[model samples]
Target: MKPVSLLLAVALGTATVVSAGPAVIECWFVEDAGGGRLSKKPSALLLRQSSESPPPRPDLDPERYLKVHDPAGTLLAAFRRYPRDAPAPRCEMSHYVPLPASAIWVSGLTPEQSCPRALDGRWLMVSMSSPVLSLSSLLRPQSEPQPEPALITVATAVLTVLTHTPTPRIRIGQDALLDLSFAYTPPTPKAATSLAPGPPPFGLEWRRQHLGKGHLMLAATPGLSGPMPAAREGAVAFAGWDDDEPLGPWTGNGTFWLPAVQPFQEGTYLATVHLPYLQGQTTLELAVQKPPKVTLTPAPLIWAAPGEAPPELLCLVSHFYPSEGLEVEWELWGGPEGRFQKAEGQRWLSALSHHSDGSVSLSAHLQPPPVTTGQHGARYACRVHHPSLPALGRSAEVTLQVAGLSGPSLEDGVGLFLSAFLLLGLINMLGWAAAYLATSEDSVEKVRHSTFLYFSLLILSPLPNSSPEGGCWLGGQNPDLEFTQTCIKSCHLKHAT
Candidate 1:
C-alpha cells in the first residue's frame, strides 16, 4: 500500500492527536548495545481499524513489539502486522520534530470517535496498555536485529531558575531551594510548531568551585567528599509533576532542591541540565561575605583646644569580603537638644587594605570642623555601611571636649605689662619729688625705702593665691586700692625707723 498519512491518535482521556497532514507512522526501536552506544532502528507500517472491530485483547504479548514510555511513564507498545507475502513498508528518515512523546501516547478513544477537524477526517486509533516501563528498558538487549545509531540532535535549550529566597543573591545560613525548568527549543520553527505544550525532559547536575578549592561535584546526598564538609549536605531531589498538587498552570515541570547554604559555602556554583539531545548551564556566584566590624578610634572623649580643629575621626571597617560597597558616613549631633546633622567640612580620606585571607579592611579618615568652647560636648558619629550590614548600619560615636587655652591670652598679658610700666614711672616721679623736698641723707633714704615698698606691694598683689590657707590680703573687696594702703603703712613704718 502507498505510504498513507497516519494520524497516530492514541486514546488518552482527552483524545489528543500526535500528527497530521500526510505524515508516515514510523517507530524507532532503541536499544543500548553496551559501551555508551544506542542502537535505533526505524520500522514503518500502515494501521487501519474499523468501528466494528472487536475490543483489543488485554493480554497482548509484550515481547512481540518494542515497549516505550511517555514522559508520564505510561506504557506503550509499538508493533506491526502484515500478510506474510507482502513487502515491508519503506521507512523514510524525517528530521526529528522534538515533539513531546506524551502527545503520541493518547488513550480512551475509539474508531467510532471523529478525529479533530484539523486532522482533515483522516486518523487511526490504537489501544495498547501495559505496566509502565522504566527508561532502563530501552537499554536492555533485544532479541531482534540491532539497528544503526540514533540521530543525536543538537538543539539549544533554555534553562530557567527560580529561587525561593527573598533576595536574588543567596545569603549565608539560608536554604537555597531552586526550581529549575529546562525547555528545549527545536532547531527550526517548523519543528518547534509540532511540539506539545509542556516542559521538556532533562536531568540536572550540580558543580561548584571555591576560591582555593578545585572544581567538585555537588551530589544530592550526604557523605560525599568535597572541598568543604559543609557542602556535602547538598542534594538534588527531583520534584515530579503532580496533577493533584497543581503548581499554578504549568504542567510536567521538574524541580531540584539545592542544599542549605552554609557559612563556608563560597565561590561559583554551576547548574547544568542534560536534555535528551541538548544541554544547558547557568552559574551563581556566591562570595560568602563577612559582615564588617566597625570601630571608631581615639576614645569616646576627644579633647581639643578652643579654636582648633578636632582630631580626625577614624572609622575602621575590618573583616569584610568584597571591598566595593564600603561606605562611611559622618554625622554631628550639636544643635539644640543634640539634633542630627551631617558633619560639616568633613573631608573623608579612605584606604582599602587587602588581607591574605580574602578579607578587606577600610580605614576612613574624616577631619571634623574646628570646635570652640561653645561647641564642647558635641558628638561625632561614624556610621559604616556594607552589603552584609543591616539598613541602619554599624556606628561608633565620640564626644568633643573643647579645652581652655593653655596660657594667658595675648590681651591679658599686654594689659598687665602696660600697668606695671606706668606704676614704675609714677613711683620714680614720687621718689624724686620726695628726695628733692628733703635734702637730708635720712630723708632721702626714707623716700628710697618707701619707693622700694610700693614697688614690692605692686609686684606681690597681682600674684594668684597659693598659700596653704588659700587666703591673700589682695583678695579684699577693694583689692586694687587695698594694696596701696598696705604699701603706705609699711612705708611710714620704714621712714619712722
Candidate 2:
C-alpha cells in the first residue's frame, strides 16, 4: 500500500516546498467489525512521524487538518481540527470505503475524550477491500459486481506534513510499498448466548517500520495508478530520530470520565481527549444492574442440660455477585446489653463458593460459649459486599435462643423455699392470736402489757403485712393506741357471735 505521507503532502500543502520541514502525522488503519463497531486495533497499517528536532507546538488551532485524494482524483479521507477554547471541546472525523469483494461494510470510531483542553490531535480512519488481489474476478464475467481497485495498490508516499511555527519546519512523511504478500485468517466464531452488555473497552495503536539504507521500487501491477517515487526516501519519510528532535510516542497519556454522572446508568457515553496530540474518541455503553440480595440462615442452638457443650452456630450469606469484589464478614452479638463483636479464632470458620448462575454463597460456622454468666441469648450477622450495593454491605441477622437449661430451674427452687418459710410464719401467727384471746379476762393494764409483748413478737416475725401495722400500734400515742384497741375489741366480739 502507498505510504500516507504522500497524501499528507497535498493535505498539509507541503508539496510545493523545496525542503519539507518539521511536522507530525500519525495515521491509523481501522477495519469494520460490523454492528456499528470497529476492531479494537487497526489490522493493516500504522504511520507515525519520527520525533526529531523542532519541538511540537504547545498550542493548537481548530483550522489544522489533513485531506487525501485517490489516484482517479476522488476525495478519499479528510481529517479536520476541532475548536477547543472552552474547558472541553468536541471534534469528529470519519472515512467511508465501498469495497464489494471482502463483504466488510462497517464504520469505525476512535476512543474519544470529552475534556480535551490539554492537547491537539486527529484520527484518520481508512477502510478498503481486504484480500486485495482476487484472482477469481479475472475469470468471472463483468455482468456481476466486481471489487473496486485499492486506493493505493503499490507502496508510495501519500502525505507530507510541515510544522508552521518553527523556522525550518520539520517534514513528517511516509512512503510504503506493497510487498504483494497476503496472510488470510479465518473468522472467529461468536457465542450463541450472551448476558447483559457491559462497558466496552476502546484502544488505539500506531507503529513505524525502518527499511534498509537502499531505495525501494514500486511494482508495476496492472489496474494500479499514481505517480511512483524514484527512490525509497522520496516515496516515504525516511527521516529517523535525530538528537535534535524530541523522543517518544506520537500521542501522550490520557484519562476520561463523563461529567456529573454515574457508571451504573445504562446508555452510551462519549469522551473525547487529546494527550499532546489527537488520537481519537471513545464511546462506552454502561449496563444497568440490580444489587445483589443478602440472606442469612443461622444454625439452630439447642440446650438439653446445664453443663452441655456449646453448639455450633452456622451463618449462610446468599445471593451475591461473583465477580471477585465481594467481602463477607461474620459478627456475633449477645447478652441483654447487646454488645456486638467480630467472630474470630479457630472455632470460627468461613468459606465462599461460586454457583453456576454467577452468584456467590458464603457460609460461616462458629461454636458459641456455654451458658455462662452473660452468653444466654445471642445473635449472628452476615455482611455481604458488592459494587452494586448502595451501602458498604447488606446484612442479615439471626438470633440464637437455647432452651431447657438448669439456670432457670435453680432460680425456681430458691423461690419455692422462700414461699414455704412464709407459710410457716403465718401458722405461728395464728397460734399467738388464739393464746391472746384466751388471756383476754386479765386486768386492763395487765392485758395491755401482755398484748404489747405478744404483738411485738409478731412484729419481729417474718409474717407478710404484719410488721408495719404492729410497729405502728406500739409506737402510737395514747389516743391512737386506744382507737386501735377499740377496733380490735369490736372485731373479737363479732368473731365470738
Candidate 3:
C-alpha cells in the first residue's frame, strides 16, 4: 500500500497520526498480548479507494510471537497483509492491508496449506476493511483538564505550591507526604503518572522514550518538584536549665515549666521538623529554642537573738519558692538560745508570735544592757522568736559613750574664758589658712571644721572623757585639770556643775 493519507482530521484538536479514511480519529495500533492491559503505538493508516487489491503481508518482530487475538475470540489473526489489487506490496513487505470504503467486511484469507508459510512484507499486496471512524464519535480529546493557568502564574509564584496538600516547608531528615492531585481529567475515569528525580529514580517509559531535558513531563497540571537542592543538615543544641544544672529534653514539659534549652552546649541532634528553604535550595535552620525561666527564691531569713529569749526586732526577713522535692516550714525562734529575757516584774514575753497560716516570729526585747551590764549603756535592740525560723544569733550593735561632767570653773570662771579664747584663735587660724591656700594651684583647699567638731574634739580627745583638757571638767581650777575637778567640786557644792 502507498504511504499516503486521506481525510484524517483530529476531532479533539490533537495532532493525530495520519489516517486513510475521511474519519478524524485518534488511533493506536495495539499488539495482542496474551493477557494484561493492551499497549498501543503512535502510527495510523490513511486508507483509500485504490487500496482494495490483495498483496503479500509482513510478520511481527517480537522475541516471542502470536497473531492478534480475534475480535470474536474465535480464530486469531496471526499477521496482517495488504490488498494485492492495490499498489504493489511496499518494499517487498507489509504489515497491514487497505479495503475500499464501501466494503462491509474483510476475510482472514485462509491458506491452502495447513502449516502455511510465515508472512514477510516483500511478497504481495493485500486489502482490508478500515476500522477507523469519524472524529465526531466517542473518542476523548487530548487537551489538558486542569485549570488553564496563566503564563504569569509561573512568574508570579512566590513559593512552590501544590493544589492538593498543605504548603510544607522542605526539611532534611523529614518525611514528606504529597498528594497527586493536579491532572487534566476526563468525564470518564482514567489514570496518569509522573516520575521525579533518581537515585535509582522514577523514569519516563510509558511512551517508550527517555526524557532528554532538565525535568521530565507528566500528564498532569501544576507539577511538583523533587527534593530541595541543598544538602541535608542535622543539628541540635542546649536550650536551658531547671535549677542550677542544665536541663534535659523534658525541660519543656508541662507547658514548659523550665527552659527548653541551655546556654547552647556543643552537641549534635537530629530533629524531623519542617523548615523553609531558599527557592531551589534545600536547607532548613535547626537551632535551639529559648529555655523557659525557672527561678527560685532563697529560704526566708526569720531568726531571733541568742539565749532562751526570743529576739524582738524580728520580722519576716523574706520569702522564696522551694525547688522540687523540697518543702518549706516558716518558724519562730525564742528562749535563751534566742537571747529572750523576762523583765523583772512585767508579763512574760510570748515565746513566739504565730500567724494563722502557721508562719511564726519571735517576741523578745533586748534593752540597752543585759542584767549583768547594769543598764549602763544604750547598746540596745529588739529581738524576735520563731518556732521554725532561725535564732537571734546577734543583736544590731550600738556604741556607748559615758559623758564626763564639766566643772564649776568651766560654767562661769577663768576656765570658761580661756576656752573661749582658744576657740576664737582656732577660728582665726582656719581663716588665715583658707586665705593662704585658696591661691595655691598645687594644693587642696581647706574646709573649716564646724564648731561641733571642735567641741567633740575637746570632749573626746582634749579631755578624753577623763582628762581635764579644754576645761570640760573643772574645779576652781587650772585649765589643764579643769574638766576632772569640775564634777568633784560640783558635788561638794550641792549642785552639779
**Most accurate candidate by lDDT:** 1
lDDT of 3 by residue, 177-285 (tens): 2221101111111111112221111111001111332211111101223332221111112212121211101111000011222212112211111101101101111
The global Cα lDDT (0 to 1) of model 3 is 0.22
TM-score of each: 0.37, 0.27, 0.15
Displacement of the residue 374 alpha carbon in candidate 3, Å: 31
Number of the predicted model whose TM-score against the real structure is largest: 1
lDDT of 1 at 341: 87
Worst 10 residues of 2 by lDDT: 132-141
Off by over 4 Å in 2: 1-103, 107-281, 285-293, 298-309, 334-338, 345-356, 402-497
Q: On TM-score, who's better, 1 or 3?
A: 1
* Model 1 residue 83 distance off true place after TM-score fit, in angstroms: 64
Clashes of 2: 46
State in Å the error of residue 285, model 2.
Answer: 6.6
Root-mean-square deviation (CA) per prediction? 23.6, 24.3, 33.8
lDDT of 2 by residue, 219-243 (tens): 1211123443332222222221111
